[model samples]
Target chain A: MQQMNQILRRIPVWAVYLIGALPAPWLFYQGLTGGLGVNPIEALEHRYGELALQLLIGVLALSPLRRFLGLNLLKFRRALGVLTFTYVTLHLLVWLVLDVQVPSQIWADIVKRPYITVGMAAFALMLPLAVTSNNLSVRKLGPRWRSLQRLVFPAAILGGLHYVILAKGFQVEPLVYLSAIVVLLMLRMPISGVLTRTRQADST
Target chain B: GVGLAGMAQGAAAQETLEPNTWEEITSYNNFYEFGTGKDDPAKYAGALTTEPWSVKIDGLVDNPGDYDFKDIMSEMTVEERIYRFRCVEAWSMVIPWNGFELADLLNMAGVQEGAKFVAFETALIPDEMPGVRYPILEWPYREGLRLDEAMHPLTIMATGIYDRPIPNQNGAPLRLVVPWKYGFKSIKSIVRITVTDVEPPTSWNMSNPREYGFYSNVNPNVNHPRWSQASEREIGGGLFAKRIPTLMFNGYEKEVAGLYEGMDLSQYY
Candidate 1:
């Protein structure tokens, strides 16, 4: 366990980027080869959305995993954040270019449909975090950088909410993911002060 | 036309309908009685016993009894009718169905006076159907059509596809095929048919009346509240293919337009 943690700590962020990129080629191969059964466009959109949500949840879970379990995955959190944004952007593009296929209708759907509205809101929230997720911004902004990054929590919540609303009828899977995010947020509230102290120590 | 006359017209029917493969039809389906997933029906519907099927015809009809499957087949003349099947989800497919007109089946039972509507019921085998385990919809999926609509030549009781018996997942033995209305209106695996003076309560309308109406005619103008009805994707029309504009009454407007001439479709819908 100690050796594993040491390896995780020492691992390059580029490795994370490479590992995160593995699914894209596989998905593209499936899409091009007609492996995505029946409706490949819909399948691609759903998968990218799911991957984005999963990575967002992973980003939310990082602090709790480090604080409680004495295991740290903090170094890769920025990479995870950027990868989540990449997936979300891909998901949106697929919906725009492949599924709806009309600029006017796409704008109408984003504005009119509650599910799309929430999903777009979630994607919009992730934008600032993705932009400022760098060492230069961290050094320049200092304490404000952490505050700006807190958007991840709301982004995660909205992402989960988007999934819940998109489901046709009563579905348990999205609810389960939403509940997990809620619990993670609740777990986060009590240790907020401790989080600041740990961060200060890391910077020193 | 009956028997050999209907069989001889198969070539003419093939010309109008764009053919879909049996693989495409079998794989992609929405039989919610089995499950909500598109592929769920095929995986779980093998448990359904289709051979010993009997449909109970009741209500205002003169002949009210459990009609055997074999008897129903022997009495009616089956024909291949190529139809455009549109779902409420805004996806569609062209299917070549083999069955007799639903009016012929009603005529066999002798439609009594004052029968305004024809109500149909799906088989309620809780053991065979996983979806029945949930209250996502009321058990024994029910759908109905106006007597005039039911008697239309386009309304058929499908038993076969591509010269073979329909797979259990695709509503085997007997299923209603109303080409003009949304696909769900054509209730699958029908176990009961009732003629009534009043409109029957359909499953989707009862589940959520706002989104789903009793008369789910395909209209591009009237949106589905959540999604646009302006266009639809054909199932076998390729992954990246553009969605074509949806037609009024799914292109059967000429045949069915006269039925609802006096009534307000927007209000009724």
Candidate 2:
């Protein structure tokens, strides 16, 4: 166990992010190769889109979890966020190129459909977060790093709302992600006698 | 002496204006004001003001009266009709509708001269309806039919379905039934029926003219801007993509196409 701990301690953060994402590409490739049996196309799109939102919410919960639960799992949040962008890109590519063969229709759908508009907005917000997750970029910006990373909360809410309205029903599976995000947000609220030092600094 | 016989002939013709094949009438509907989904209108329409219902008969009707909802349904015996409902959105349902022909009630109300168009409106009530909370669609749904279309043998006012009083969800008290057209053409929970000289504004056409039109017939040839109309999936089927070919006038070409003589359906659509 001690040897294992030593090995893990020496592994670079970037290397952990790369190694952790090994399963995503395999799942994507399996979908591409027609592994999903019925409604393979729709199933492929659902899996990628669903995972993107799940990982996004997971990343949003990290900092708060570390502070309250005394768990520092946020070490993996940067990697998970970048992984979300990768899956979102794949989802958008499959939908734009495969489902809507007509280019004009795709353009029209993005503009006309409310669900698509919010979905695109969520993806746009992720681009910057993924880019700045690295230590080098975070160090370069200093204080601005915290502000930029804070966007994950709203982005997560938008992604959840997008899926909810598009579904048009209270589907149990997708509702789980929405409920999780809500609980995570609720966890961050300052209960009685439990204010953070940052809150005190801002007040001054 | 010739005047007496002329009155008798007119009465005979009016009596047969109602349908012999009720199946063709009940399966058709106009629940699309709720959503494009086949089950949505029925599920959403339950909140409509079905209780304490009254319809105003005005404009070119001689005996206009505030008819009680139940009294109007009791005007004729209910017939059972099992039909395949086709939607403009490319979905379908096989429903057993129980109701009477609309022409019988219209003639009883005494339609007068120059009654060329039959315009209808849903009882607009926002208080009970949760869907109205959001402006997902225009309120007080409207639909219209030409004079001949209104008097056609296939036109009906459905009161029940699946051998029971029409469920509140499926336009409880009274719902229009016009076979040969897509289901949305059949308006539900009607509050007013106006017999006028000109065509009136329909809900879908007024909201999205490019997507829906006034004379929205069931023609597989004309595709909706968002979806293909050539095929439809039956309700209660699993998520398989299997679809059946849609028929022109929903398989009522023998009775209806003769009415629109020489007009271009594609243009009107």
Candidate 3:
């Protein structure tokens, strides 16, 4: 386990960021070269959105993994968060610039569409987390940074919900991903300890 | 009409419009009964048994009975028509289809005088079709058209495309092709055709009545509550491709607009 930790430490955050960002240019190349098949815009949008959600889920899993499994992925967590935001931003940009070009309609879609509304809310929540995912902000804010970063839980839930709502019918894949996130969140929660502590305080 | 007469010349005189490539036709499809993904039907539809198919013609028809697939093919006069197929999802395709007019088949059935609507039903084999496990739509996928719309020359029963048997993904064996309306209205893998006086319940309209109306005529003005219908991106185009303005009736207004002459299209749509 110590050796494993040393090996993980040897892997740099820059390498993580570099590897994480690879899908973007590869997807762009696929879209440009017609490898995305028919309806490349939709394919590109879906791929970026899925990658963002996956990275966000990975980032969320880090804490629980370190606490329970002796696998400390803390060093790469910030890079994963930033990469997730990057994918989400690219997804939104593609939808705005290429798919729905009309400015008025774009605003109308964000306002009126339920899925888009939830998705934008999730993105909005992620904005602050991404902004603060740096050493300078981490040191300055200290404990407050931990509290602010907890917003990722809600963002992750919303991201999963967005996918569920966007699918036209009962799709197993999206539901499976959402269920996995739920399980991860449950694992991370301190429900039992909180309840026991409250009971002890009442006795005192 | 001159177009109908030209069709009598058979395959050599086939009209080819802005036709989608054969690769596009076979690779990309949205037959939800097989699955929802564009390529899912292509991947999973091999389990569907399309050959030796028969269609049941009943309800308000004089000659109501089961018609053998091969017999129908032998009896009807086949023709070629290149048509623009627009889906309600705002994507469009141009296809060259080979089949006879639906009117010809209706005439063969000897439609009773009371018949006002022609209803269609697609095959719903749950064991073979993975999508049927989920109720995306009430099973057996139903669609309908007004008697006049069914009788229109543009409405055909397509059996083949590109002079080859249609791939199973593209509604093989037999399917309805109403060029002017949204593609979903053209039910695929048909198993039954019923002539009824009352309007039949359509699958999409039943699933989400507000979003999908019974008429489902391609209209640029009336948006599908979720998305705009003002424009459509042609399939096979690359990402960042410019979408073109959608035409009213999908560019078939000159031929079919008169069918809804006195009614309000916006309300009906």
Question: What are the lDDT scores of the predictions, listed in order?
Answer: 0.86, 0.70, 0.87
lDDT by residue (tens digit), candidate 1, B152-195: 87789999988799888889989999988999998889999999
lDDT of 2 by residue, A118-150 (tens): 888888887888888778998899999989987
TM-scores of the models, in the given order? 0.90, 0.60, 0.91
Please, what's the RMSD in Å of model 3? 3.7
Candidate 2, residues B119-229: lDDT per residue as tens digits? 988777766554554444567778899878888766778888766777655676887888778777888778889888989888878877877889989999987765557
Ranking by DockQ: 3, 1, 2
lDDT score for residue B79 of model 2 = 82
Q: TM-score per model for chain B alone?
A: 0.94, 0.83, 0.94
TM match of model 1 to true structure: 0.90
DockQ of each: 0.47, 0.06, 0.56
Q: How high is the lDDT of residue A194 in model 2?
A: 64
- In terms of lDDT, the poorest run of 10 residues in model 2 chain B is B20-29
Compare the candidates by TM-score and give the number of the best one.
Answer: 3
Clashing pairs in 3: none
Q: Which stretches in model 2 have alpha-carbon errors above 4 Å?
A: A1-204, B1-49
- Tens-place lDDT digits, model 3, residues B37-83: 88899899888898789999999998999998999999999987888
**Between candidates 2 and 3, which one is better according to TM-score?**
3
List, residue by residue over A66-164, the lDDT tens digit for candidate 3.
Answer: 755668889998899999999999999998998988888888888888889889999999999989888899999999999999898898898999898
Give residue B105's error in model 3 in angstroms.
0.8
